[model samples]
Target: MNQMALDKAAVLAEALPYIRQFSGKTVVIKYGGAAMAAADLKAAVMQDIALMKYVGMHPVVVHGGGPEVSSMARQMGIEPRFVDGLRVTDAETMAIAQMVLVGKTNREIVTHLCAQGVKAVGLSGQDAGLIRAVPHRHRSARTGEEVDLGFVGDVAAVDTAVLETLTTAGYVPVIAPIGLGPEGQPYNINADTVAGAIAAALKAEKLVLLTDVEGVRADRDDPGSLLSRVTVQEIREWMADGRLEGGMIPKLQCCITALEAGVNRVHIIDGRVPHSLLLEIFTHEGVGTMVVK
Candidate 1:
């Protein structure tokens, strides 16, 4: 056999044990970044999720479409605004977010999975109370005062009954990050936060976050400084010493929360890489940083 064919065989052999180990386990994936933006990466992600289902693992997708929302808002002559990195969602902005996230993004993901020969259902937090939301208050670092981000909310609770039913019936669930408020209002939520909460509620085997950058690194500038694995304690220390900052801080905090809430592992991987989800799950030398309890 040729070298290429031999390598394929080697890869399959390497994945066999992991496949068996995680068979029938649930994996929650936060789909975003370049993976959702690029056509090729989007196809690869859907393929990876389909392969996981075929191999006896349950895969749940939670997706974000912030750029898409902003683009749409701009087209409608509304300028998008942000405070403390969280979108300042007004009533009109919330409508656009819902239209983009639930109506457009969610259905597109479902269609992709269906094309891969899997049963896919698109849903939002409004469906079956899958997510209960409360207003997300942002404390401005510049002013040291609280700011109300209209229609921006945090996950208060996740009801997994619908999710449980869908997965048990061999269907993949694609969720948009729009949550339902106490007064039947819809709020825009962060997809990563939604993914973490869903994983916690389901007690998933893995909560995988697809990001634009490589996993956590000892030095942000050095690609070679990527830490293959880290523990909750180590993450706490980094946060304490100010080594972690910006968007990564919130993501790591989500990871730590998922770990403490009974998720077996959480991974921060570069979604820009083709088949990154498969590589992280099936390979011994994973392509991301994994967090553990």
Candidate 2:
């Protein structure tokens, strides 16, 4: 055989054990940012997920559509507002979010998966009360007082029954992170938090976050400083010391939450690379950081 053929054989051979170990196991993937907007990358992501299902692994996708929501907001003449990096959502903003997340982004992913011959069902957090949420409270930066983020919610619980049913039937559940309150009111949720909650609730084998960056870096800017593996305890220490600051805090918190709630492994991988999902899952030198308990 030629070198190219030998390389392909070796790649498949390396994935053999991982495929066997992951077969029938559940994986929750949080998708968003640059990866979602790029056409070629999105298709590659879908192909990876479809291959996962074909190899007998049950994979669930949770998507965020913040940019799409902002674009619609701009077109509608309502200037988008943010407080401490979180969208300061009002009733109208929440409506736009739900519409973009469920209507546009969710269906787009489902279509892609189906095009790959995968049974994919598009759903929202409000469907079947899948994600129960309460108003997310944030501290007022100016007054140091607790304030409510209009229509934004912190997930209280997840109904895993529907997910179980869909996955067991060999369908990939494409979830939109928009939750429903007890009174049937809709609330926008952070996609990472939503994915972590679902992974924990289902006790999923893996929680994969497709991020824009290349895993967690020790110096933030130095790619060579990327830490491939770290425990939740270490995460907490770095968080306290100021190394894991700003945007990284929330991501790490989600990972910690998943690990504490029983997820075996949580990965934050670069979403820019094509087939990054497969690279992170099936290879020895995974292209991301893995967080463990």
Candidate 3:
């Protein structure tokens, strides 16, 4: 065979196992970080999702627009604030969140997927009451005191019927995490938490988080210290040892929560790399960390 044929065969070989494993199975992706801002990376991510759909894997995209919302708020002279890493949403901030997340970001992703020849539909958690939540209480990191961040919520339940309907109809569901509260009020939800809830509700085969870094590292300073695979117990041990701290702490917590809730596996990958999703999901040597139940 010629070199071109050999390369084609190798590419197919790398993808066959993943195609077999995920075909007809649902995979929920929580897309964020650099991929959301970088135009090239965003295009790559859409292409990867399109290819996944073409190969028979069902994918649901759940996205976050924290940075964009904050930027827009700043432009509007509303200073962004956070309590315990959760955005403190005042009435104005809540409106901005909805505009940026559900309106701007969601539509952009849907447009990109369509441009890539994928059938895509954008929906907020408010649509069809897909995700319901109650106001979330912010806990102090130092004293562990609980304070309510009005209009900010954690997902209490997800009605997966809409998601299933869209996927069954050959449309990729692009979800924004703005949910309705118990009182029929709209609330801003953490995207990672929202993704986990959706994955658990769907009993998805995998939950993939696209972030800025290359997965979880044993040493924060060393990129080579990546833990290729970890279990729930091992993550607990890392937390106990104070190795998992700061921003990564909540990400790992989300992964552990999803795994406990019946997600078969969760992966964390660097969104800056082109086709990172496909590399992490299909290749033998995955590009990021994988957490299994």
Q: Report clashes for each candidate as comma-separated counts.
A: 0, 0, 0
lDDT of 1 by residue, 49-159 (tens): 999999999999999999999999999999999886789999999999999999999999999999999999999999999999999878985797999889999999999
The Cα RMSD of model 2 versus the native structure comes to: 1.3
Candidate 3: where is the Cα deviation over 4 Å? none
Reference-based lDDT, residue 133, model 2: 94
Error of 1 at 20 (Å): 0.7
| lDDT of each candidate versus the true structure | 0.94, 0.91, 0.90
If scored against the real structure, what TM-score would every candidate get? Answer: 0.97, 0.97, 0.95
Q: Let me know the TM-score candidate 1 reaches against the reference structure.
A: 0.97
* lDDT, candidate 3, 1-293, per-residue tens: 99999999999988898899889999999999999898899889999999999999999999998999999999999999887688889888999999999889999999999999999999999999899988887787778898767789888889999999999999999999999988788999888888888998998999999999889887888978988988889889988987776667767887887888899989998898999999988988988899886
Model 3 weakest lDDT span, ten residues long: 242-251
Q: Model 3 — TM-score against the truth?
A: 0.95
**Candidate 2 per-residue lDDT over residues 1-293, each given as its tens digit:** 99999999999999999999999999999998789989989988999999999999999999988999999999999999887668889999988998888999899899999999999999999998899999998996568898767988999999999999999898999999999997999999888889999999999999999989989887887879988988888888888886765557778888988889999999999999999999988998988899988
lDDT of 3: 0.90
